[model samples]
Target chain A: MAVLNEKMIENTSLNRKDILWMKIIKQRQLLVLCVPFMIFVLIFNYFPIWGWIMAFQKFVPGKGIFGSEFVGLANFKEAFTDANFINAIRNTLLTSVLKISTSFVSAILLALMLNEVRARLFKRIVQTISYLPYFISWVVAVSIVYMALSPSSGIVNEMLVAMGIIKSPIAFLGEGKYFYGVVAFSNVWKNVGWNAIIYLAAMTGIDPEIYESAIMDGAGRIRRILSVTLPSIMPTIKLMLILNLGNLMNVGFEQVYLLSNPSNIDASRTIDVYIYTYALRSGRLSYGTAIGIFNSTVAITLINICNYISKKIDGYGIF
Target chain B: MEKKRSHDMLSKIGYRRMTAEDLFLDLFIYISLLSLCVITLYPFINTIAYSFNDAIDSVSGGIYLWPREFTLRNYEKILVGNKAISQALFISISRTITGGVLGVFATLCVAYVLSRRDFVFRKVFTPFLVFTMYFSGGLIPTFILMRDLHLINTFWVYILPTMVGAYNIMFMRSYIEGIPDSFTEAAKIDGASEYRILFTIIFPLSLPVVATITLFVAVHQWNAWFDTMIYNGMNPKLSTLQYELQKLLTSALSIAATDTDATLASGDSQKAAVTPMSIRTAMTVISVTPILFVYPFLQKYFIKGLTLGGVKG
Candidate 1:
């Protein structure tokens, strides 16, 4: 709870210097270092901000930002009433819960298993192979999943058929019912290993002395893990959960966009996809921005709320 | 006599150290880890094999953990059919290396500046940068701004828009400030210019976080496709590897999945099909090759760099 910079931190105490070069130099090096960052910020970040007014106006490219007619909050009101907006919100919240839970459980289970392995060589190979899928682009990853799940001749359907389970192959990606499942499962497969990396990183930091002490007390492996390993990684677990909850709205557009079909659109249209469709297809820039602004506002507010609660409850958050 | 006695003692200790229960725990751990690895690695290996195996073999449910026909035709499909992807690879590679290297340099400079308490604007700049993270002009505004600047479909759009990010800057800053100030003062007193001090002293010492951010930015640039899709639409040449890979997925698979023509001819030796599964797999391999290659150099950072400048949990 202590404020690291509480005193308004006069922020000084550099060594005194000569008159000729150092007089004018008042840390000129610092200024020089900052110039490029300043330029990047101004051009990419700040300039684009001026276009926020497009949300208010009709947003004609020919009319320009300044020249457009002010429609006020009409775009927002329309977005509010839209069925697609409602569905998008519901879909976003639902899928995000599925995604985070699936990923969180699988990664922890994986880390627990990985930690207990005694054969160092086998453990290393397993860890490396598991994490390989993490590095591939989601765009490409969707393809792999699509191929494996395709209705006519996918390995999954083939195995199911060979086992005489189903009379017909299920169109896993094409229909409304199965699309969400596929999305969440694909997320788990791609991220579980990568997510385990953090927990693994956290676990290695646990003191070896604890294990020795646990052994002395006749504590077994599971007991030692539950008592020592789990507790040690709890801080990371809490921090990551809070951060995940905050950014829960941001389902990647690439995956849904690539995988979704007209039949599955009703199920898979998250907020990002909704806004993308509105903007790209309808050319309703104002309406799209209104939706984007609404989505982002919720995202930002949630993140802040998470940060505040994390700090208040556990005394940890990424400030 | 002492050695024989010690061996007896070690055997006694070993006998006492582990029981059937301990062996069960070890066995359980090994089983779980192995299963987890299979679940994780299966899809990746399947795709890799599918890319090499004939498209017919793959689509027909033959390809799984290993290749069937062992043909390079899928790789050939991508390189031969699309000149756009080939061009995009060169562009992305140059941008990643140059942009990545320059990003590190610029980040180092800013981080150093921010690290110094003497820098008056350090406090002023910190939140200003962080503010952008939480809020941005939505896609429309950003697109309009890009159009206004005429950065659309240009090489500069790829490089300049995300040249230096605030978190990365903060990461480097926190790291640089963690270094002792005395080193910088000592270098300064020896009449080393600021640039010289940076290159010689600060950079060498700051390698851990620098390496960390380098991987972050490089991977980010490599994985980026949304920007290409939105900003450089219709410009096939500007399509990054990710973009090209996406096109292969959607255009090839999404469209082909529906058309009965491909399905009807599915059994044929028809080169007419162009093999959606194979192309997708091939593009996946191609897109991932750079990450796999650079991975060896940067993999150490996954643990070392992360923990060294680790944020307080």
Candidate 2:
């Protein structure tokens, strides 16, 4: 009987191919609709990926990826050995870690606080106001930061002097030590509310009876939140954390670029910035591609590892 | 045990009532929220204040919350001072609308096709879309490709290369999946073509996601300067508002670095009266005002879209 079923399936698949062609003919317009998009994806996405071969080659302008010398792992080795490359990687990781932790905490706290708000109007207004910065461009945002922290003419310096907190203005952007903190804080301020939306959504899904029961058990609002709300949202928290862990290397290019200058280059030169400088600015195409290859490889590996761990822990993975 | 029992009894009596603890908590929450609101709005307020103040007076500093010596000259300069400013504004607006509409349409096409469960080619194409999200050719090769394609230094490069976003396509696909298969199946039985069913049915049902992606794309286009910086490459005609703003700030910084105020003067005496700081503030205001204007009405949709992605995605 099993042999007969297998034979029938094989026969059906043969027929299925004919049916598929029929369906294609029927849905010919849909295929036409998808054609332009497919071409776009190919040119914009796949073409670039195919060009990654330049990372392995001594790529010259006229030679193209095909005609270039395939020195094989030499560029990768060169990238790994460079002090600037290592610094970029280090800076990327440091800022990413700082940003992830700070934003994660801020989002959680804000979401919790928002959840505690009794007045609907107040919560909505606060939430609305907070998301404004998220929509503002980093160019504008960086300008705001620069103006606010400008040594000679900044509001911060003025206020500090008025309050006698300091006799002189401190060059916030000119220092290396403050760069990570500044980037992290600015990032948190911009994204905290937006990030909190996910947590708030998860909170809304928590069963109301759990909170009722906690209250019945004489737990205060804080205690109820701790025992009921936090526990219920642990999966979401874990999910977001793992997702963020995957992006540990992408310390947002725009923010770093806009904020970075010669003074803060020591702390601000992330991998993306480094690649941009080499590849586009200096026109060291092959060397930059090699660094990009390194950056992407590490990022993909981190994501996979995080996905693996997430699955192991919770039977759920992004992939 | 007795104390616990008494506490439970007391709590049960006042479960609906605000206790002293609740009162304190409410106070803390309100104070914290208000403070946060102030902090969030302070820089924006400061920018506005600086934008209106006299340029030279602003250089003396200490304009914190409001314009000290109020004037409309800075805005006048931005509006009528330079043709590039208005030109950049037009470019920014045009690109935002054009890019947003086309981007959404292109993304939706990929998403709708991929959403079809019976499409035999979906397995092949879905991975093609998803693979791009994780890996890319990197900067130089892609730039080289754009340069080779002659897409460099053109407006098409802005819209075409970014026409489709992989994550957005996936998000839309996930959204479309939530739409019942029965509707499409019924349409199929009625002899409605796939495109007909998609346009007539799926498109209407997927408005929330569509609106979400539109806002996302529009905001991105509006905020974009890096592309202009790279692709446009000092082509003043193609520069967007944000790019022009960056240039203004950069030039101002460079000037501030070398000369104090004498050589900073431009041919336009009106603009020269407004210090670079004030001019920059005005430019910042110009850059942000449009987003701020439209944000309130669109805020709910963005929040909804995010939660939709969070839950289903």
Candidate 3:
């Protein structure tokens, strides 16, 4: 009886295996479609994680990752002690804070102003023109900024001098004091229109009856906006804020890199640019990898913390 | 009649008579908006004016909305007089088209597979793909991987790393899932394979999203100079228009700095035959013209795409 029971159990397990195999065979076309992408993702996305091991090693290009000496947390220690890295962290946080706050407020304000516009053609034209900068490359945008701020010939300087706002043209990009402000202003100029789309979308979902009731209550346009529209879009505002806060670490490598000249290099070198300058440019591969790891860790932790807070408040997380 | 109805509706909604305060508010809002438009547009107009002004003449400053010394010389120098600019332009266009096409097709394939609710592995693959959106292996690792794959300094470096984006895939999948399953079900019932349904039915249906993704990827590729700077910095043959523009801008700024210093020393200003300002402005125009050409289509679809993604988020 025991032998018969054991054989029957074995036969049932084999039958379950057969079922799974049959399902895979029947869905072979789908499998064929998926496997290549899976492989691509594995190679491009997953395989890079293997290189993170270098963060713990004294990695050398000649010897490669495998032959590199095992240094453990020394590289990470070096990163923490490095003055440039610390300064980079400060710049990254400072610029990111400035950028996030300014862009957020400007985008919302622009949307509110746009929502108040009565002329559809005027609104459409303004919106279209605003989005123009967002689409162009930072290279082109920076070039435009350079020309517009050029002390010798830029319209900005010319206008300022003409208006007697200053005795002479100021080199906005040539000073460290103006770096963060210029970065923040340029960010708002590029993204304010694009960013406003979300708030505008949130506003569209506001019930018209709410506005009608406010108007009936003797609410002026400003009061109606303050009470009806703002409250209605509060959730969206929170979500956008949380999302932006989550990305506090990534202060846009390309924008800062392009904007940095020798004059502003001290203020503009964020962690991302630091990694590039050290690892790729100067060939300190392992130390760069260590800093990169630190940056990623902080970013992921921030995202999770934000995600948790969002879930607590909204009952749904971004994930 | 329509205007009358709208007026009636407005009144019914308690539209008050325009008080002096209301008129003042209206004027404030309109003027603010008008100024915003000017601030946004004045830069481009100024750049265009500089590009068209004579090279030496632009050095004297004060060109605002229109060219003071109207000449085609700047455009001529960029479009015809220079070999490097043309080569960079060619490379930029080629990469944009190739990368855009391949990226769309790859994203669609992955999206279609994940959109299939009946597919047994959809649950597994969806999360696996979406996780990539939140985390990455960072820069150095990605650069090392490119080197290992022999993609460094090659044109393929531009195409491959960006071929399959998680955000685009998710966007495409959400769009694909919106299409009724009945169509694909009917195709399957007719003994049509998944490939057939994807090509004959899904691709045609997903053209709007396709155009949207194509624009996103193409613009990204066109605007990308960092990749060229990192991966192909050594190879002039593979230099993109944006990268070339970057090179030009750097040299121009340095030269302008020294030129000013020289003037300061001598207490007299001298104009070069062709200033770095003119070349930089001309290159800027050349790079931006293609984007402006496609701006209308971009404006139409990108808003739709943004709202769609916004809803999903």
Chain B superposition TM-score per model? 0.85, 0.86, 0.89
Per TM-score, the best of the predicted structures is: 3
C-alpha TM-score for every candidate: 0.88, 0.92, 0.94
Cα lDDT tens digits, model 1, A1-319, are 2465643342332232233247347767667778767888888888876777778888888989878899999988888799989999998888888888888888887887777655668877887777677777778678778777877657777878889998888778777788778888998888787788778877777666566667778776678779988988898888888978888888777777777867688888998888787675678888887888888889999999999999998876667
A1-319 per-residue lDDT for model 3 (tens digits) = 9999999999999999998889889989888877887788888988888999999998987788989999989999998889999999999999999999999999999999898876779999999988889889999998888787777777777788999999888888787788899899989888898999988888877667676677668887778778988998898899999999999999998888778877777898899989987677898888988898899899999999999999999999999
lDDT of 2 by residue, A19-130 (tens): 9899889778778878788898899887887778888888888887778888888888898789988999889989999999999999999998998876679999999988
Which lDDT tens digits does candidate 2 get at residues B1-313? Answer: 6543554554455456778887788788899889889878999999999899887777666778898888999999989978998999999999999999999998888899888887768888888888787777777778888988998788888899889899889888888988988878888888887778888999999997888888888999999998999999668889899998887666644333233333454433744486667778899999898889887887777677678778753
What global local distance difference test value does model 1 have?
0.76
Residue A8 in candidate 2 has what lDDT?
100
- Which pairs in model 1 have colliding backbones? none
> What are the iRMS values of all candidates?
4.8, 4.4, 2.5
Q: How many Å off is the CA of B213 in candidate 2?
A: 1.5
- Per-residue lDDT, model 3, residue A14, is 100
Error of 1 at A189 (Å): 1.6
List DockQ for all candidates. Answer: 0.43, 0.47, 0.56
Better of 1 and 2 by DockQ: 2
CA error at residue B236 for candidate 2, angstroms: 1.7
True contacts kept of each: 0.58, 0.64, 0.60
- Model 1, span B150-246: residue lDDT tens: 9998877877878878878877777787889888898788888778888899999988788888988888788888888888867877778888777
